[model samples]
Target: MIDGLKPYAEMKDSELCWLGDIPAHWRVKRAKAVLRRIDVRSSAGAEELLTVSSARGVVPRRTANVTMFQAESYAGHKLCWPGDLVINSLWAWGKGLGVSQHHGIVSTAYGVYRARDASGILPRYLHELVRSSPFHWELQVRSKGVWISRLQLTDESFLNAPLVVPPLDEQAAIVRFLDHADRRIRLAIAAKQKLIKLLEEQKQAIIHRAVTRGLDPDVCLKPSGVAWLGDVPAHWEITRLGRLIKLTTGFPFKSDGFTHVDDDIRLMRGINVSPARLRWDNVVRWPMSERPNFREYELIPGDIVLGMDRPIIQRGIRLAVVKEVDVPSLLLQRVARIRVRGDLNAEFAALLLSGRNFASYLAPIFTGISVPHLSPEQIKAFRLALPRAEEQQKIVEDVTVRTGAIRSAIDRAEREIELLREYRTRLIADVVTGKLDVREAAARLPDEVESAEPARDEFTADEESDPIEVDDEAEIEGVAG
Candidate 1:
């Protein structure tokens, strides 16, 4: 839909450093001139609670996977209606602002704004424009704090920020063009994701077969008493994971001490673990001085860490193998580190934890409604049909060789999705910032039913930035605007 787009015919300087040249007809206005801050408090806190996320704008608090406790009374929380823009004042620079489509209540610390009656801005257009890269830079420059992580965007700063305004018709065109472009990009991403899923499923089948039935297809089967394992190789032994591996759950670290200092030891929270790899993005750190006090929590190469909280996500179980680069890291709460004890192969244990059977074993065992979790006991109690140590190593080696191509294919698909997302981000920035004219392209597009917006979890932050933490805002009563 964004093919062969061209620049505006005439242009003029916006004079705002953040927003450079704009179409000649466009006007630049202070955000306060175009938007009015609203602070209607919810009388009874009965409205649906909302949250502002960096990757997704304003959404229901229930949809967010937060571990924070909810306020007992939300009566004095800020009330917002459809088309209102909600900004996480504390994280505005992280792109934690979006125009809401639902009537809800937000954090008392959030700033809610609505377009003035006479303002020639569309909420949808504003949503895109503010979230663009240029606006992120503007917000970061205006925010105040001692450090980048704690930066806060005050009311005066947000109100004084310059806004690029296109004509009402042009704003609608921009919105339509970007929406169409997003739909196309999402569909492309979905296709790639589907391919990745199939490849992963195929790889899992190979691992499951090898681990369960062994390399010999015609081997004699025994009735494994475990309900999950119907039949295993006659020679295989069924034993609980605790018998072969030592499980260590992380210590309860204080969040107040969490730092962003690069040289400090990284606290390996659940967020840092993905399917088969550890993601250092969104890491929290502890002081190097305190590291000596928690020597037992230190991770080493070949350790297997699993996210006990929400262990199973759409992608897969959040289990990853610790590597050499991930050391100098201390395990944090809600993550489990498994180390080989007697004769189990670390890689083989990882295979079991990452396989489909383990996921099935865990599916029904998760306890908690808002944030499902697995107790260290539950994880240790998992029973696996095991082969002897040497045979386990042989199976791992054989499976690795067989699944190499499939893994490579999955990586390629993932990389393609990343590139598509990057392209979408660039397209939105260019279109909204007047670098590309999408009016003609929008007008030529056929009318179609817009698919439901993709779920927020499907997307990650544009950078390794902080996510919305409900506890960041105190449960204070909001005052009138």
Candidate 2:
């Protein structure tokens, strides 16, 4: 903590209401007291423009990450200059404020304002103040709209708002210190992202190895003679998918037939199956009474579900395994249930379906003009390399053990990344709004702000335009036109 700062006990009750404690000597004031609205206009074809982004603050016009067709025409927008505070009034409640560093036009929705004086209020400090929790609460209290909420902060309402301001020098120092800490956090995030990418690549390699080559590298190899598979263990047989598994089409149940029941039975559909797992959340319900010949479509432990619809088949791959032979679950028409037979291991067969070689084999068989689909006959005829059951189990075990470890590590890193992002948001909210003393920390910050540039101004009124006409006169004019 910085020197000369103490717990905010000495402040009067009215001076500090929501914020539990503050530094003894600090004074509380409203946000409007230090904020002034700056007004300027720009023509549509203004050469230089500036855009404010939710992620990156104010940035040059060309640097924004928006589709060109979606951006403002730039014909009639507001003008902005370096050092002015630009805030999106509509999005201000979400912390959409930043100090501009480029000269250009901005969206009309933004309120471009300058501080009354640098001595009393620093631009950086004010930027932080508007993002404070209390300030956001104020915005929430004042905003009004049926569906699209709008916050209209009048001059009086703004200036009368109060906040605790540290000394001018301390404010600057805090900004500098927080800036440095932010950079470190960002760098750590980048490192974790790179690690994730590398782990994913490793996972792909493991899958490719297990499916194409058996676990024993010492085993003799031979040409599977299948173009997609290329080669396999010498002892393995090249067989059509139909030979190794019984691929059965699912029963078509009408929407009217679906009933809400408190039963353990699950109806598997194309949507229920993702790449590697089953999503049971948005499942359609069916009554046991409606299930005629349910045993014909019942899912068994180790059975793999493959979607036959075009959209779902494109992401077809492997869905999930019936880990337990529990209650009867019917398969929907758009899905194909593959039950391993002959000398094939169910897990190994499922792994093959999830592997690259099988995907390559099935890709060409998908038929359709717009949404490509796979028929049961086409899927059955798909060629694959089939190893003996014992070898298949070994390969599945090896791949699962290795990939599971990598997946666990990746999941942990992803969770850490998410927490870091949340921490970053809280930290910025605190330092920027003066909730925490960050002046001493700010002095140690690196000069450069190294995140991606702000997104370009791409205001789409078609999206933001009001659906209902505000005035009867306007409605009449629209009808007349």
Candidate 3:
């Protein structure tokens, strides 16, 4: 179906600059003409709570991370029925709105809209149309706020925005085509994700063996006393991480003092630390003039940075070794910078942290419900079975050489997944905006049983910088600008 897609034979100007030409037979209608803004309040907060996510659309609160809690008594929360459009008014610019598939209650801060009676718009079709790439620009430009992330899309603005109106039959066809494409894409991505998971597990097993049990299988083994460690080589030392390294928690730099100047020193927030990699994409900068005041927070090459908050995800522990390029960076609050105190190889320590053992140890002790966190003490308390300095260095080298191919394969799979996502994004935009006619292709698609798992897209997967959380105020609490 995807391969045979082509633009409609007859095209006409959409008049809307963002959407140039749509199918000639389709009508471009103002949103208000087809949607009625509804604000019905729940008599009692008895319905399941729902949240609007740019990644997952409207889903039940229990299915996603809960960033905030509801107040006592559910009375007066806004009511949302199945097929109703729920928009997190403050986050609409971020694609934080979608048509609900389940009836529930949402925060009062959200705007609920229903297709007007007799309006030809299909709920599923409108959901895709408004979330298409071009429509995101429409929401961003119409949203009002000083900070881009905080922009609020007023009810009137959304109601006045232009929407494409296809014939009911065509709308159904578009939805079917996109739905089928989505299912196929999900399966492809799942395969890649599974491969990555397997490769990671294999790589981790190698590291765990190298770190816990020395490279030589003939080496002597003895009870290590630590339950997680089980047994280790007789010559190895079992010690807390703090005994071998100096740990420094970041200083609390005021947000107002942060700058965007590239020449300024980069601030390494907890979010900047991903598993095995340091990400500077979302960094803040401290003024060069104020550099001398924060000498202790300065990060140097060979330092290992770890996110103290939500330190573990499904992928692995959040930690990375700093390289020469990562220098000129300062550690920010909730992140820890570690320096070897003696002969411990930094690479070996990183392997220990990145391995499954550290995560298992941290799992039972980490605190916080909405956001799990690691205190400096908790991180320092992790125990590890360490071999001699020479043995540690040798083990690191051997593991790196052995796992190189696995790492490459994981990278290739990740790149393929990225390409698939890009294709999906473009396909939705072209098909929904009428740049490509999917009706004919839709007709050719064979019957497919819908999977119980919701379709995962770029918005719903690893792409979100932060977990979108909802609180009593009906706001997405974890959005990062």
Please give the distance, in angstroms, between residue 256's alpha carbon in candidate 2 and its true position after superposition.
29
> What lDDT tens digits, residue by residue, belong to model 1 across residues 127-169?
9988899899889998998766578899889999988989989
Q: Indicate the residue-level lDDT of 26 in model 1.
A: 90
Per-residue lDDT of candidate 2, residues 150-220 (tens digit): 44544444446565677778677766665555566767776776787688678867978887887777878
TM accuracy, model 1 = 0.90
* Candidate models: Cα lDDT each: 0.81, 0.61, 0.81
The prediction achieving the highest TM-score against the true structure is 1
lDDT of 3 by residue, 221-333 (tens): 99989888899999998888888899999999876677778888888876577678776645668899989999999999999988776677656777889999898989888
TM-score of each: 0.90, 0.54, 0.89
**After superposition, candidate 3 runs with Cα above 4 Å error:** 250-271, 279-298, 324-332, 366-371, 452-481
Once fitted onto the true fold, the runs of candidate 1 whose alpha carbons sit more than 4 angstroms away are 147-149, 251-265, 287-294, 452-481
C-alpha RMSD for every candidate: 4.0, 11.6, 3.8
* Ordered list by TM-score, greatest first: 1, 3, 2
